[model samples]
Target chain A: MATTKTPSRLVLNGLLNENPIFRLALSMCPAVGISTTVMNGLMLGTAVLFVQVCSSCTIAAIKNYIHPRIRIPTYTLTIATWVTVIDLVLSAYAPEAYKAMGIFIKLIVAFAIITMRLEVFACKNTVAMSFWDGLGMGLGFMFGMVTLGFIRELLGMGTLLGHNVLGFRPLLFFALPLAGFFCVGFMMAIFNYVELVFNRRKKRRG
Target chain B: MARLRRITYLTLGFLLLAYLLVFSGCAGSQNRFIKKTSFRGTHSILITFAGPVDEEWATKASNYRVYEKPDPDIVLKISTIELSTNRQTVILHFEEPLNQNQPHMVTMRGIMTEGKSVGTAIVKVRKLYLGYLFSILIGAMLVQNFVFTKYLGLCVFFGTSQKRSTAVGMGVTFTIVIVASAMMSWFLYQFFLKPFHLDFLQIIVFIGLVSLSVQAVDTILRKVNPMLFKAFGVYLVLVIANCIILAVPLILADNEYNAAESLMLALGAGLGFLIALFLMSSVRERLELANVPPTYRGLPIAFVVAGLFALAFLGFSGMSIF
Candidate 1:
């Protein structure tokens, strides 16, 4: 795996094969909680991206310095610092998004994505490679959240980013919790379908 | 010695941080963000009831004004008379006073009846912050219940409902964690985020706090009560990811609850969550043995069961118990 070091594969894998929400299905808290709006999805995805990349780099760079027993603590501290920085900035500048996204932003500390990457990629890879992996994973999360938000917003309110894209009629139930389940389930199905197609195409070519 | 020292240092750090938070008034709303609504001329007595009732009753009681458009100014003397299967009781308390003689409509939301069946009570609120807290709790917890309203966290609802004992235990456990974690998270947000201008880290902080707290609880449980720890070890770990825990703090922070109000809301929300989970779990436990299923073995069938239970919960939203 280390010898392969394929950036394109890393990027593609993060988006699809190893997608944070769809494939791995970790971090459902934020996925379900914040997918009410596209802007929320975007902001949270960006924040997670920042934390994921920075923490991945730190973990890779300090792979040797960290004691096996204390690796979790060190990773936590590193992640916490970055989270603190992001939380402060969001509250100061984008108070609404901060408020809307709420505890999910702070939840980045325990998000399985960061720790998973550390255990899987960052621990074994170079700092630069870890950064790219983080980016790929972050983008994957962004894709999942944005898609969930889009489906939810569209069906729930007949709007995208608070705009009336689908005209005057809106499905009231779409804004309800059931709508969230429907949207997420629908996206997961779509993800599986796309994965199936992509895999089939790859098999045929090979 | 090293482990003890580390524990001491971390505990002290959290306590000091908490002290600074309280000193700075960052733990909550600091009694700010109170907005008054237009009041009606009549003395809008906010009458709440037990469980879910007909909307027609509420509309008739408040003369339909409360149902149509909420008037902001009338001082609402809120009370409830709950009639349950066990007995009938009335519980009363004081809310913030309203601007006198202002035209306002009273709406009945659910309130804690203190384990009583039928209860009647009146509450008056004068402070804007208390009013804000009161309204938000009503809106978020009862009116639009996270369990009933948003229908979030149903996964745990089904997951923990295998037995009556586990259901009750999980319900109580969830309540404790929810109340404690919500308060802590609110404090962290108020003190850490606002003053230091580190509010952007709210999610990371909250997640960190929850994960650490859950892990700490797991460690302490293992050491102190190994039997109890072994019983619900897996459940305890799973609670870390429970969306209810995460959602509550987010709601509290967004609402800007003061310490006292935040605590109350947490208690209420936790109770509400427990109520929902325990009820569903009990029902699901009974349904476990008797089932006709070929395709719908696990999650899919659980979803359908949950949808039915969710429908039942929706009935309670109309309860005039506030």
Candidate 2:
């Protein structure tokens, strides 16, 4: 974290290397609960993105002033404050999405990734680094959700987004909570395998 | 030293001031009529009342008016109305299938259930008695297991569940915290948040409450028994961040559950999580000897196992436990 990398690199790091769901596996509840469809995933991801970036920046700005003993509570409050803002905004502007996401939005206050970024990177790093990191991590989570959502929606319901594509449900099982577990499991394996191959190829080229 | 203390105090005071301001601003917030609404199928709406209504009044199709929430211009016609065996639940069937995604409104002349006599009210829905409470507990534990069905708390579900002993220990500790925090959350929501229309601050308040409970448990465990401390110390911290712990309170608040109902739900959720952990850990311990793929060595394989368990547990959904 202290080595001082570029913003794009940090973002990519969040997307690939430190992907919150697939890589670090910090907050898996929302990943499974909200990823029943691409739209649901995208909505939750966007909300998370806003909350993450805002909380990250706020913590980075106020890091020095917060007493260490009270830092955890302060972080929770910061995350909660951001969550409340987004929760209200969504309920007002997009009541549909708000109803769909439900308690998951409020539960975001307890999400480890937001606070993890603050305690690990934002508290020690510059505001710019925290921003990029937050953006990357948020996007990474969104990527995971959309991917899982796509797989579930496409196969589970024979639909893309909300429209029917296959015209027949191929594996309706994928739509169930049971399949959510398998989809994430397989996706993780794919990510790990690709990373392994990528590492080997780079080593050979060098 | 004085300046640092002053800054901390100032920060704390600032948060309080902001909270009070929001409270005063929303002082006009009036409590909504307590009603709970749930759709059984696309065509059926089940509305539960706190008390039994006059059978004739509640069962009359003419007594209820339904409309699709977004497009309120068109009133959907009710085909038939039936009361439950217990007389606490009213079932209405519509000519057209109700849209699950769209929120619907039901205006009844008088419930004769929730303290209203003659005024028409927009019904939301809510509960019943001992048999009902038992169903809620079982529904949460088995039929609607939070981990397998609702997909909450997968982080802790997969993390500590590597070993059977640890999983069970974590389950007990989690149940303790969840029950304790759930009661506290219920009390706070009923007394503080509901009346002031400070519902927006729920996330922050609940998180603070959860973390505080976790901290208390951590301290007490450390003092009481070193053996217990070694087992539950790590999970006690992680429990604060677990989704199930936070989810129970939100659900109770949404359902407008009473103290008894909330307690049952919290207990059910905690026990459900414990059961899930126990089952997963048992399988996971056995998986240690099995050959899992290199890429799917640890978590990936565990997830697959969880998927299978979820499938198995899903069979209970058909049971008429009540």
Candidate 3:
């Protein structure tokens, strides 16, 4: 984490090295729960991004005021406030999307990934650094969700973005909640393997 | 102190075991109990049985006859009975839908249940509120277990469920928090959101309520019961991220359950979480020794185990206490 001294490095670290969902394995609940469709994934990712950036900036701006003992609750308050703002905005601007993602949009409050970033990155870092870190981490999370959603939606329903690209639904099992777990499990395993290979190659080159 | 805690654990374990055994042993065919009857549309009548019905009899149109209550002349001929995928509900279609709001009388004569019980019931809306509550409890626990079936709270499920002791401790802590937060959210939504037209703010309100409840419990436990504080205080923070804690309130608001029903749902959900934790922890502790592939060892294997558990829980769906 300390290696991420530059703003761009922080963002890159969050994007690939410490990808919130795949690498860090944080926020798997929301990551897998609503990522059944790409649109769902994109919306949730955007909400997470907005909340992450705002909460991180808020925590960075007022790091000294919050006593260490009550920091978690305070951070949670900031995240919840941001979540509410995005939630209301989505409802006002995109009622249809809001309806589809209404129940879950509220649940971004409990995403372990957001709270984790605030504690680990936001409080210790400067506001600008926190913003970049939040952007990077949020993008990383968005990337994971979209990938999972792409896999599930494409294979489960045999459709891409609600379009019947395959001309037929295949393995409708992927739409079920249990299938979400399996997809995530396999995805995480693949992620681990790829990361291992990447580090091995890096070591050989070094 | 150790003995007391041991006894409590033993008793709770025994109760859970007995509940499961008794219910499973009684897994005979459900009695032909009429759960509900209502008008589906202008031309159809919906009949919902408490459990899976004998499809052969349910589909047979000759077994059912429908007529208006005030007069026998007004009879709606059953064109066909379309059974739902679950087979517990069958919608009776007609040439012309029953448009009148008057009460309708439907009768069945042949075998309708798995036990081959002769079906007989005066088509009426039975006030089975108590039965409804009981079903809600069972539904939440086994049929729709949040962790295994609904797939909520996996973070804590996989995280704290590594060891049996920690799993039990976390499960107990989660139960208290979910119940408290669910009730608070229910109250806040009913009084504030629904009344004042501020439903959009429920997520924020719920987060605040859950965090406050956890904080309140934290302060109280620290002062009032040091032993419990030591045991569960560590888990209090984890409860915040538990999807189950937040999901319960969202569900209650979606369903618009009354105070008593919400309480029952919360209590049942809490116990269900405990049951799921106990089951998973026991299996996982054994998996610790098993030979697993390198990549699938820690969490990947656990996810597969959870999927298997989900399949097992699916069997509980068709089951009925009646």
Candidate 4:
């Protein structure tokens, strides 16, 4: 596995191949809760990016020491500790942002995407590879969230990042949690369709 | 070897930064004098402070004053000031009943803490509405639904919502577990965690409580009704990891709702989940018969339907019965 794969491939795999939200459908709770506005999406994405990278790197470094039988609980404890640290830091330095995103931040402790990454990539890979994978997955989640937030905010509230973009909300339903399902599902289908077309074109040329 | 060493150093550095932030966070926010306030009755108010108040300085009537708007001349007399045993809460008793319609401003000046004046805090007392129970029910069930609004419990929601019967079973089990866990966590939080000031450990504690209760319910179900357990045993275990289960308790704790309100919230949230699951399962069952595109047949189409339902529920957003 190590001989054939490159770090860049690992990163790309997370971004396009196995995005946490659009592709794998993990951690949809926060994806819906925080995607009401573009700013919220970006903020939450940044927070997840920080926690995902740090936790993956740490898990990779300590993979040898963790017992296989109890690795799940250990992973949870590790994630919880990092989430608490981030929660405290945000509340201290950026109180206003923390107030808006604090509950969602704490909810990251139970996110399946982080756990899935730790188990699938971080445990077996080197620290560098795990870090890249985490970074890529984080970026992918951020991309999905920001896109969803942008469309939802633009349509639901007639704003983008609180700036008025439309005179009236076309469909306020986009801002609701139910819209998250529709957005993610439609996005996944479009992504798959695009990938299919790209692959087919490449195959024809070859 | 160099790369490994760098990784080690990076991990250690991050840990050190995290430690520093944790300690600094406690000290940095301690200077704020007032925490929050709420109404105890029509006439009285309960004020909570950031730290323990100096009983000698806080008990004096002159330190506290209540004013009405516009004129600002009516000073409601303080009949008594009672400090809680923890000294974090002070109950101010007014001589006369306050006007329910007019907003009153209560100011406590020169609040001493550790032999130093921590400045003053003025709080506006809005009239307390008594229909919080009804509003919480409507809010949780409709406005901020656990499934449709918050996107919690999706794993179980999608997993068990294929058939209507299974949906009903999972929903009932989920509601029971959620309400039970909410009550348990509320008791633990109010009596032990908050009093001891270990509120930071709430996440770990609440998760533990929820898992334990789920385990208990699992055992009871298996023994009492083996058939029902067989239907929902897998999802019952999944409840331990369900975001909604943990979220219910966490939200209740964060909002600091009283016992009745928390129960109502749990009920509303649970009912909301049940309703969403039931609706989704019924729709999916019908969708099985409808001809659709190959790619959008299953989950994608279901999502579109859920979105339409969400749009319908948006009509309830403007409803303010209270």
TM-score top scorer: 2
> What lDDT does candidate 4 reach at residue B86?
87
TM-score of chain B of each: 0.58, 0.63, 0.63, 0.62
* Model 1 local distance difference test score: 0.63
Expressed as tens digits, the lDDT of each residue in A176-201 for candidate 1 is 65455455545555665676788889
Q: Write the per-residue lDDT of candidate 4 for residues B1-322, one digit (tens) a residue.
A: 3433443454355335434533443321222577766667767888888899898988998988888754588788889889999899998888888764455677778789888987877776644433545677778998877777566777667778899978877887787788789989999999999999999888778776776788788888788667778877988866755788878888988888767667778878887998999999999999999997766756667667876777677677757555
TM-score of each: 0.62, 0.76, 0.75, 0.69
Candidates ranked by lDDT = 2, 3, 4, 1
Error of 4 at A36 (Å): 3.1
Question: Candidate 2 vs candidate 3: which has greater DockQ?
Answer: 2
Angstrom error at residue A19, model 2: 0.7
Interface RMSD list for the candidates: 4.6, 1.1, 1.6, 2.0
Q: Return the clash pairs for model 4, or none.
A: none
Clashes of each: 66, 6, 3, 0
Off by over 4 Å in 3: A1-3, A198-206, B1-126, B223-232, B318-322
DockQ leaderboard ranking: 2, 3, 4, 1
Point out where model 2 deviates above 4 Å.
Answer: A199-206, B1-128
lDDT of 3 by residue, B160-198 (tens): 778887677677667667777888899999998999998
> What DockQ number belongs to candidate 3?
0.53
lDDT of 4 by residue, A1-206 (tens): 56756878877877878888777877777776668888888988988888899999999999999999667666777777787788888888988877877578888776778877998889998999899999998998898889988988997899988888787999987876567777867876777677778888999999
Q: Per-residue lDDT of B217-256 in model 1, one digit per residue for the tens? A: 7788689657656667888866754667766777777767
